[model samples]
Target: MPQCREVPSRRRVPSTKITVPGPPADLVSRPRLLTVLDGASEAAMVFVGAPAGFGKTVLLAEWARSRDHEAVAWLSADAEDNDDRLFWSAVLEALGGCGRIPDGNPLRLLAVPDAPSTDLAFLGQVADALDELPEPVVLVLDGAQEITSPHPWQGLRALVRHQPAGLCLAVSSR
Candidate 1:
C-alpha cells in the first residue's frame, strides 16, 4: 500500500486557501439557485461567473456546505497561486483534505515538492485515481480568476478532459 505523503512545505500555503468559507452571517437561502446547482451536479464542470458583490462566493459556499454525501474540496485562489507549483500544490492539499480520496492515492504524489506541476501524464494519473472514487467529490475553485498562469491552466485542462463521473469541477470567477 502506498503511504500517505505529507503536503509540500516549500511554499507556505495559507490555511484559509484550503479552508471552505462558511456562508456569510447575513446569508439568505437561495433555494432556486441551490436547486439549479443541484440539478447540474452531473456536469463535469460548472462555471459561476458574475461581477464582484454578486454573492458568487456565498452561493458556492452554501452549495458546498449542503452536500451530505458528496465531498467538497474548496480552494479560494489568490494572486500567489499564479505560480504553477503553488497553484497545483494548493489544489492537491485541498483535495487531500476532502476526506474522499482513498489512502495511497496517486493524487497525493502531486503534493511532493519535486513533483512536476505541468506534467500532463502525471495529471492523467491523478484523474485516474479520482475516476475510481467510490463517492463523488466536488472541487470548487472560488476566485479562479486569480490563476493567470497558462501552465496551471494546461494542467487543469488535462484534468477536465479526463474527468470521471466521480469528480465534478466547480469554479466561480468575476
Candidate 2:
C-alpha cells in the first residue's frame, strides 16, 4: 500500500446514513408470515403497510434472512431521508453493501453539484448501477413512512418500473 502524498479535496456529501435491520435476538419464527412473505421474492415490489407495532419490521427482517442465496440491502429511513437526492443516496449505499456496485462511494456521485435533480433521471442512473450487481438483491426500505413528500417517491416508483431482473424491493411502512 502507498501513502497519499497530499490529502485530496473532499466534496460536499449527503447524509444517506442507513442501517439494515437485523432480526431480534429472541426472534419468533412465524411460518405463516414467512410463507406469505415468500411471495415477494418473485415480485418486483412488496409492501408491508400497517400501523405501528404490527411486526412489520420484524416480518421483513425475517424475510430478508430466510434465504441464503439472495443478497439483501437494508435502508432504515429517517425524517431527513425525504429528499430525492438523500433518499437515493442512502439507497445506493445500502445496495452497495452486497459487495457489488464496485468500490466507489455513491454519495460522492450523488452530491456532485452538476448532477441531475429530477428524480426519474437521477434515480434511473441509480437503478442502472444497481442492475450491475453480481447477484440479485432484495432491498428493504424500513420506516418508509418517514418520507412525507410525494416528490421523492416518484423515484421509488421509477425504480420498481425499471427494476432489473436481479433486484426486488420490500418496503415496510406505517
Candidate 3:
C-alpha cells in the first residue's frame, strides 16, 4: 500500500477561514435576499456567483449569522487550498469542528493529520452519514473561484451528486 503523507499543520489555517465572519460594518441589509436564502434552506446546494465587488461575501456572512451558529460550517477557500487533499482536509475540518456533528462521527476519520487520500467512496460515505443526521447543517464555501484545479472539483461534484437531505451546501464564486 502506498503510504499516505502526513498533512502539514505548520501553516495554521486562519480562524476566519473556518469561522463565520460577521457582516461588514457598512453592510446594507437585504431582506429580500435574506428571504430567498431562508427559502433555500431545504435545497441541496445554494450557489452565489458574480463578479468581484458584488458583495457576495457580505450577503453570505449576513445570511449565515441569521441562522443558528451551530448549524453552519464555514470555509473560505483560497489559492493555497487548490489541492485535492488540502481542500478536502479543510472541508472535513470545517464540518467536523462545527458543533453540529456529534463526537466520533465517521466524518472525523478524514479530518485527522495522517488520514488517507479522500476519494469518491469516502465522500459517498460522508453523504450517507449526513443523511442520517437528525438536523440540518449548512456548509458555506466562500471564494470557491480560487480553486482552479479540477481534481478537488471532481470530488465536490461527487459529493453534490450524492448530497444528503441534512447537508445543505452553499457556495460563493466569482
Candidate 4:
C-alpha cells in the first residue's frame, strides 16, 4: 500500500479594497467642473490622471452626487490588491454593490478556466446585465494607478470596448 502525503490547506482571503471615499461635508461645490464632466459623459472613457491633492476624489464624488439618477459603481483599489484575480474580484464586488450585477450571478459561470475567451465572456455577461438596465451605469475604478500590471489594463480596455450602451468607464489614477 502506498502512503499519501498530507497537502497543505489554502484559505481564500477576501480582497481589502476600500470602499469609495466620500467628499468632506463642508467641501465647496464646483459647478464648472461638474459641467465639464457632464459634457465628457458623451465619450466612452473618462480618465482623470493628476498628482496628489488634485481633488480627483472630490470631483468624482461631486459628479456622483449631481448625477444621482445614474447607476454608479465606485471601487477604491490599493497597491496591495493588484493581481488579476483580486482585480476582477473587486470589480465584481463593486458592480454588485451598486446593484448593477445581481448576487450569485454570471460570476459563478465566469469561474471557468481563466483564458482570454473566458475573460471576454465574463465581461460580456457584465455588459449584458448593464444593457438591461433602464438607466446608464457608470463604473468608476478609483485609485487605479496602484495596479501596475498589464492584465488589468487589458481587461479594462476590453471592457470599455465592449461595454453596453449607456455604460461608462471612468478611471481615476494618480
| Model 4 TM-score, 2 decimals | 0.76
Model 2 error, position 133 (Å): 3.5
Better of 1 and 3 by lDDT: 1
Error of model 1, residue 9, in angstroms: 7.4
Q: Which 10 successive residues of model 3 have the least lDDT summed?
A: 110-119
Model 4: residue 110 alpha-carbon error in angstroms: 5.5
Candidate 2 — number of clashing residue pairs? 0
lDDT score, candidate 3: 0.79
Q: Residues 1-174, candidate 2: write the lDDT tens digits.
A: 998665222232243344445677987878887888786676888888999998888888777777652377777787876665566656765665554445663422443122223535566666676666566678888888998877557667776888776678888899
Residue 27 displacement (Å), model 1: 0.7
lDDT of 1 by residue, 12-116 (tens): 578899887877779899999999999887899999999999999899989988986339888999888878778877887888878888778766545434444
Candidate 3: tens digits of C-alpha lDDT, residues 97-150: 777787867765544232223554667777887887779899999999998978
Error of 4 at 42 (Å): 3.4
Q: What is the C-alpha RMSD of each candidate to the true structure, in Å?
A: 4.4, 6.1, 3.5, 5.4
Off by over 4 Å in 3: 1-12, 111-118
Deviating ranges (above 4 Å) for candidate 2 = 1-17, 100-120
Q: Pick the candidate with the highest lDDT.
A: 1
- Model 4 local distance difference test score: 0.67
* Model 4 lowest lDDT segment of ten: 7-16
Error of 3 at 54 (Å): 1.3
RMSD of 4: 5.4
